[model samples]
Target: MEVRLTREQVLALAPDAASSKAGAGLATDGKWGLLGADAEALWGECQGSGSKPYQTQVDLAGLVSRCSCPSRKFPCKHGLALLLLYAAGNPRCVPGTRPAWVDEWMQGRRDRAARKEAAAEAAANAPPPDPQVQAAAAAKREASRWSKMEAGAGELQRWIADQFRQGLANLGNGFEQDAQRMSARMVDAQAPGLAALLDHAVSGGGRDLPSLARLGERLGLLQLLTQAVPRVESFSAARQADLRAALGWPVDRETVLREGEALQDAWFVQGQQLIEHPGNLTERRVWLHGVASGRAALLQDYSHGGRGWDQQWRTGYSHSGTVHFHAGTVPLRAVASEVQGGTASAVPADDTFDVAAQACADNPWLPQVPMRLSAVTVAHDGQRCWLQHGEGTLALQLAPMPGWSLMAFAGGHPLCLMGEWDGQVLHPLSAWNAQGEQWERSSA
Candidate 1:
């Protein structure tokens, strides 16, 4: 436990305090801490003699419980001292003593953790998945994705049949346009499924039996997409988003981004979601952060094809700030539900569709988790480089390799794959799509 520091020791450790002698202490209500010019709250508990003065700490999100000590737990005095030291510009953090109060709390946490371990061990020893139950979930996911894909395939097939009945002369040209639309739709279907279709369509002249087999497979996939609706309620919200993407549902992110592109304006982060297809593919997302008004806009790149690709993307969720779309040096910015359009809402609600398992039954609550992706550069040889994201990075022979997506970060290191970066911590971007149940951590 940390020794109680005298007021003098606290001030001595604070180099930024304009005056070394502190005013009477109770601003923190018995918690002796220091406030800095930068507004970070820091308090010191005295440590061993005088060799070490004060132990400072900064806030880390999503891990700590709230501190009800009158101080905003967000940047309590502990955090202030941390900022003071950090602001001094040295990146190192020193180990310091924990006061009695904090120590007591830590002990209680350890006890609870031990209890949790016992409970988990008990759960692990339980029986295997009821084959019936496992079958049910897998069946549900497959059925769902297959349904939509079947419908899309049927619709496309009908269109093709109609063209054939009309005649084959202009069929090729019509097929070209149709293929382009289908290609975009495939992208919406979360990539892997789309890739399968593309491979099928491009590999054959339609009369080849192999191509025909692929066509049938695409139809089967469409069926899976169609059936996913009923199963949406059965899976977690996040899985539902992924299943939807697998089924080819549109995220409409491209719409928001395109408007930002045309006007070169800022967008709000309304919502974010991620989905995993059957293959090595995974998606990332960020809800576009929003802005209310004014007129300044960021410029962007124009595709020679003229058709904008924004509508296809789902909104991204994390991140804040303004970005110049077309500018090269600046990394990137985010999405929008333009508050200027009137509503200046903070943290947009998750819009990804949720098809939970028979909400008709008692089950667990599952929500979609937004996918985070970063484009990183990969080095094949000392001299060669390729920008990789998603599965590409996973397939690489790099060191420690990379993590799955921006959604998972480890000790300041990026965890996910995104195409396009050759590895210089570039602006990470995501495809914003929705899927369901297929990636549900638990069916229940």
Candidate 2:
């Protein structure tokens, strides 16, 4: 498959081509030679400010892998920006053999494909098990899990009681180690629900004295499960499911990965934080904002047991852009601001909440505001903001001062959608809606 981009389109996409080329930053005439007639489908390369160039080849037929950048954002910005440059007739070098960097990438792809094929082959060749045999084995395992859960819950309850008796001076004051140890045990006991609970012991996620009584009541239930198996049995099937779910007892990974109902828009990368526990499950939060809708969204991609996100995702403040992304089963939280806008005027007053909004603040450390995640549709909404296009939105209320317009997405769910009655098309803002016990973010 061949990809083509008109010269003018490239220029619009790559505002830096003229300046970069005029500065003689690249090989003369080679840019166009590489672009050729079907430049859009060609491979892309990246040369850092002072580093050697790294090349990436994309399979035009499949829009699949073949890049040197260590980013996992499918068809990352580098890929899109490269195409944009070609469309502008400013490609700086003629396409040629894969560079050493590109070669490494090719080999990596081959290795991954080989592993996948091997795994599939192994599964296919596995001996079939009798259904009854499997069922009986499963029952025995279930019985063992219940026994383990009872012991774990009983121990956890006693631990909480001891802490309370010692006087909850500082649930978080210096319990990081304790919290971590307990959470790890909880995970082992199939109570991943308890790990975050342990984290909350100090994070203020516990809701403070204001909600302490309510929290105690919740804990009391877990404590009861310690000594009495019958009490655990008393819990309704629904309640049992809830308890197990909170325990993080292995839900269908496929379901968590489903991510239904999406919209394509420019998701702002607002703030980011990485979390790791003793067991080493790593979670990354790459928040986003839509420029047109001025809505906020979150891009949460996690890895576990010593693994991490493919890359440290970037946040951006921008003119406007779009991309393809999926919504999670639950909405993630985020802080949305412009990629390069001036410092934020102020964060929200609520200091206790993890999800809060702020004005755009282009932290001076980054090169420029990150680019759009994917191609986006532009709507002339009267409001001055950008957001994910589907269930979420970004309605930026640009203030008079040179500051940022920001919104918060709690648990990544849009509590309310802010839409603008554009002179023509109505556009979306931030979305904050509830879905079951989880929240969702919009890629749509």
Best by TM-score: 2
Best by lDDT: 2
Model 2 backbone overlap count:
66
**Candidate 2: stretches off by over 4 Å:** 4-42, 49-61, 65-73, 86-95, 125-127, 170-176, 205-237, 254-404, 407-444
True lDDT of residue 265, candidate 1? 39
Question: What is candidate 2's lDDT per residue for 268-374, written digit by digit as tens?
Answer: 34444344545545555554555455444554456543322332333222323333322222223222222232221211111111112111121111111211211
Candidate 1 local lDDT, 220-329, one digit each (tens):
44444444545567977546655544444443446445543433334543332233434434343433433443222221222221111222222222223343222111
Q: List TM-scores for all candidates, in order.
A: 0.22, 0.49
lDDT of each: 0.36, 0.42
Mind sharing the TM-score for model 1?
0.22
